[model samples]
Target: MTRMNYQSARFLTSAPTLAQCPPDDGAEVAFAGRSNAGKSSAINTLTRQKALARTSRTPGRTQLINFFTLGDDTRRRLVDLPGYGYAKVPEAVKREWQRHLADYLRGRRALRGLVLVMDVRHPLTEFDQTLLGWADDQDMPVHILLTKADKLKSGAAKSALQQVRSRLREWEDLVTVQLFSSLKREGVDEACARLDAWLADPEPA
Candidate 1:
């Protein structure tokens, strides 16, 4: 497999709807989670950049689908979906975001897989399950990142990992879960390896 130089990540564009997204030219992986679930921080850590995905103290700061290209290649892209399940947002706006997110997930041909981030202490929320179910229906692979693992003790963290792993047994073939910490940079290589596999083509030019 060709190693992706994630450090070469660069902001590409932000799209409000799927219609505005870049051309569906090559494989792309999407990062998604509820608001304040450490999705942004995980992206930054994976790319080895401080502000690549724009972490915010306030939840629901990412209101658009932000795209980033790897190594000056427009074909290999990473998408940051808007953080969902934030209570402060208006009901109408929330409904619209849900529609857009669903459409993107269901219809985007270039989307190869999803990286779902969840807080280690609070894994598998209703929203997370909803997204996971959608991926399963589409036969899309998902990698769950239990972010903020550093906040828990070593034994507790291990327990949390085991619990989530066991819960994911039903979809073991399509889903994989791992403990990750943006602060400590845990599981970076594993996460990258998964992404590399997803983005790799069986027949290369």
Candidate 2:
């Protein structure tokens, strides 16, 4: 198996709905989180690009499934799923987004794993648990990033990580949790290692 060159990533396409997504022929790991959870920032940081994934002041600006290629290969992809649970979004629209997210998670064969981002100070909101339930139904492996770790004191951050891990102990086999700070660039290497494992070609390369 070969590890991908994440820094070589470039914008591939964006699909307003899952049906419009690119051909599902190769491994892809998706980043998902609620609005303002630092998902886009993490993606940008991971790819070592200032704007690989757009960081917006508006929390729910990402309304599409954004796709990016690993290096020059279209087969290896990184997906930025729509940000969910924005309070200002209309309820009907929120439901529609949830439907599309559910459809993709349940049906996307190319999806290898999910990187679930949440603010360290507010990890595992209601929608986050809902997302986790969907992942459990699909038997999808998840790596939980307690992002914005720098906002809390060092001891507080570690405690938050421990709490998240403890809360997810039942899912230990399919879920993992770690502290991450996009601001401090902390845990970038560890996160990339998980991505490497998930994005690596399963068959002989």
Candidate 3:
């Protein structure tokens, strides 16, 4: 199969619940991360389109599972899951989002893999570990992007990358980590390459 031109990605639909998502017909990869972790910026940068995922100054602005299709094929999709760990949101609302997120991650058969974004300055928080554990339980592959790499100095950024890579050694075969700076457009190709690999496969094994 030819490499997908993510630049041709277009917004598909936003589903508040897994039941409302598009039919589970094709391979899909979901992007997940903590609130204000640069998930939106990384997605926009990956697709080479500004505002594709709706970046916002406020954390937790993405409150739904937003889908984007590559080219015109509905089978291939990139899902933007709601950002977690934003304390400002009400407890009831947060619980509801968490329930929906858990259900989708555990039940979505078409979900081929996951892209977990995190800030380089603060990688692997408690919530991140929880998600990783869940992925492990499902035998799902994950590619972690240490977003906002520009915020740290070169040495610090390298150290952060190595640290995360070292800590994830047990899951090395199923997990990959890379430093990414959406503002600098760094690591966009690498990130997309992983996404393409997942999408190319009929199902993640």
Worst 10 residues of 3 by lDDT: 196-205
What TM-score should be assigned to candidate 1?
0.96
How many residue pairs clash in model 1? 0
Using all chains and alpha carbons, the TM-scores for the candidates as numbered come to: 0.96, 0.96, 0.96
- Assess candidate 2 and give its lDDT: 0.90
Off by over 4 Å in 3: 202-205
lDDT score, residue 155, model 2? 98
Model 2: CA > 4 A from native: 202-205
- Pairs of colliding residues, candidate 1: none
User: What would the per-residue lDDT of candidate 3 be over residues 76-161, giving only the tens digit for each residue?
Assistant: 99999999997488999988888898889999999999999999999999989989988999999999999999999989999999
- lDDT of each residue in 6-102, candidate 1, tens digit only: 8999999999999999997788999999888899999999999999999888899678999999977888889999998964879899888888988
Model 1's alpha-carbon lDDT is 0.91
